[model samples]
Target chain A: MLRFIDARCMLGERCIIREGDPNTKEAILELMDRCHIEKAIVYHAMARESELPAGNMALIGETAGDDRFIRQWCALPSYFGEYMSAEDFFDAMKQHHVTSMRLLPKTCGYSLRPHSIGKLMDLAAQCHMPVFIDLGTELTTDESYDLCKMYPEVDLVFGNSGYRENRRLGPILEQCPNFYLGTGNYVAHCGIKLFCEYYGAERLIFDTGLPTGSATAAVSLIGYAEISDEEKALIAHGNIERLLGEVRL
Target chain B: MDFRELVYGQKPFEGVFVFDVHGHIGFEQGSQLGPNDGESMVHTMDRMGVDGICVSFSPGIRGAWKRGNDQTKDTCKRLPGRVFGYAVPNPFHAECDLTPYFEEDLGFRGVKIHGNIQGETPENDPRYAHAFELANRLKLPVLFHAWMPYEVDRAADVASRYPDLNVIIGHGGLTFARDRAVAACKRYDNVFCDTAISSAPDGSIEWLVDKVGVEKVLYGSDMSFFDCIHTLGKLALAKLSDTDKEKILGLNAKKIFDL
Candidate 1:
């Protein structure tokens, strides 16, 4: 079985949920076990939905004894003393063993421009911690290119892509070497093969937008992709391992 | 079928009958799709062990209808049993007649109504009545792009009107309209749903099967627009019994399409 490290997952309760969704942490773990995903880079729902600081702290409490979850925290620009300073946030992350950060520009009512997040991006670049965000919610497909250009040194991994993003993503893939995409919902036919052919597997990150996203479907896309075994390894776990391995904090 | 082992081994689903009920070919005007041609789709199917797929020319629902359908006809002709065609009707074209497509054994198994892209026309709009009537006469399946609650209702209305023809609500089972889709499946005998969406979570298929028996569910990959492998794997590893898995994967479609 190909081992997977989910780059995107959430804990805590969500506002809108369906009957069969894996909304709870235990349900998410059951899905991870079934899908052979060994570890997931996880965030808390409260951070994104209700409160950022409490949600981040809640994530620490939730995944306390569980080594299966690689900790990730939601970030704010902290312009109005709403959150910790960039230095203090990174210090807290290092203390808490958090290796990555997630951005919620639209959800938090902030901008992605360097002017708004320059300090956080600078700190992220210094530590080599990958910054994660969603495609449609945090920003538009067109703005991904701009995000990559603005934070050239910091690696940006965008998740929650649908099938209809290739026309917009093609140019971004070509121009932005720092931009990586989450493969959870990027289910376009032969999409993985075509992406591997053009951009190579290094830029593709394996993720299941878990609790809401399908871990079964996400793993199947990579396992059944018409690419070589080496490419599959890279997408399934190799690239993310490499990305997280480089984290200084 | 040892579906889990097959997925772990990354092997094709040999020895199992797998047929996709929702698919699209040709180009998408709104976005770029990967390998949308018949040959490319077949190559993916070959890798995944899918026995057959029914596709509609995506562009036909919006642009010139005849050319779009001719494209489907040509693809179905070239591919034979492996590829089947869905005859699409242009709602704007008053003279549109899908009867000719069904007259021949050109592998046209059903009708596709994607009214949302066709000026947001209702699924049971009067313009689609003609095609629905023909499908009813032939006892064929009519697949509707019903992704919303209202769209599911419209499709259910069609099922009420045409008791003979099966109405497969595409992308409705695991979407926001799932409750509506389940209600319709319970309310109408001919109403069914396909697993064609990209964003539904795990256990969704199991839930659908629980709400409306596995018989009402069919495997639909939305290939070319989305890969078949993901949805296929989802069914294989779903919490349902192997028998239910088989039924949803292909057996159900086999009975519906008369394959």
Candidate 2:
């Protein structure tokens, strides 16, 4: 089954515009049309920064109804009970057919610094789900890598990778297993080579934002990428399929 | 993963000898290197299909000398062939200027100083000017971390006096804010703009390439951290000829640094 995931590179709770970017729903359909992506996992800033995870919850709930896509919610583990109790989180996921969770510990100013939300994270792992976050910042790389290494059972994906810092990843990925990558910030120059060389194709997934840089443009280089077809399939479809396969959405 | 192979068949990148004028390695935060380092950066060169790079350490002085030096130095020692070095000279460090930066540092080819941009300088400090002259005599290109519109005069003065020296104005001088990079490049032939931070302010890289010619524009992923991808990738969207693309990517820095 060929499928595409909307990695949600950028979304404004309010409208912020890139010259060629499309709106949320339209962007996804265009991305699917362009790349033959049948399914996409969506992320949004409005949901992420909500006073409650309610915004994220609502989006997931709405999208879960669509067979063409899966809804992923942002869980502020640090702000847990306040935003939504763990029970509410479960309820929302179950209610909306939410398949996964995305975390933004740094941007949300939450402390993934060992001292905060230990139990909550452990509980999420018990539920068996994936956590996707934008690791575009410097600190998040170490933290994400370290955290994944620490919690081998937990599945994590880092989007908006620091392209130039691709070299630093080999050691980190070598140390941290069970980690995956989403490319919203990938460029043509040596980006595919770097990702394939160091991280292995098993971990790379196509998650570029739609419309503005829809899968057509986003996956163009990816389609022409030199990695093996099986490997490319994993990046293009398989890995993400397996990622969702684990969750009961 | 040779650069030629990666960029092959890519028509928009037809320019010969595109110089990655503003390449960097080394960490930025609190690690042995801060955020990104040379070793960590090498793979990206292959990924971006970059032919070669003139590397610098990560951004900010690490708030400590021992840490900062190690971060910058380690990149030079390890990736001599794959990368070039730029010393982060904090001129305020009264005792040590960029002298050792000239000699003894074998692999390192140039020097970069970031002042006030990190809340460190008053822009007109004499000692900073001394560092500029040191780079001049050493034939090392200097990338200073001071913005324009506010500090245009400072950049202009340095470039005019050291017309023979290659002084790149880091960060597009407000990316063509009030001082405007195009006007600045026109004013001083010796001065170049590091596109790392300049980027497409109003019209994208097309405007910069149009205004200053690709030779004066260089690619910088400032500390690179997470921002380098977008910084360098912006060029891909530019509507320049292939020859121009090569110049902006690596050849310009090659010509300037004589690499």
Highest-lDDT candidate: 1
Cα lDDT, all candidates: 0.93, 0.59
Question: Residue A1 lDDT in model 2?
Answer: 30
Query: After aligning candidate 2 to the native by TM-score, how far in Å is the CA of A125 from where it should be?
Result: 5.5
Q: Across residues A167-196, which tens digit of lDDT does each residue of candidate 1 receive?
A: 899999999999999999899998999899
Which residue runs does candidate 1 get wrong by more than 4 Å? none
**lDDT of candidate 1 at residue A8, scale 0 to 100:** 96
For candidate 1, list the clashing residue pairs, or say none: none
Name the Cα RMSD for model 1. Answer: 0.9
Q: Residues B1-259, candidate 1, lDDT per residue (tens digit)?
A: 7888888888899998999999999988888888899998998899888999999999888899999999999999999999999999999999899999999799999999999999999999999999999999999999999999999999999999999999999999889899999999999989999999988889899999999998999999999898999899898889988888889989999987979
Q: On a 0 to 1 TM-score scale, where does candidate 1 land against the true structure?
A: 0.99
Model 2 over residues B1-259: C-alpha lDDT tens digits? 1222322222223234444656545443432222355655565555444455665555435355445555666666677766666766565567655566556855667766666644656444576777677777877787766565546556667777776677777775434342455677878888777765422322345556666777777766553433343444345433456566556766677777867
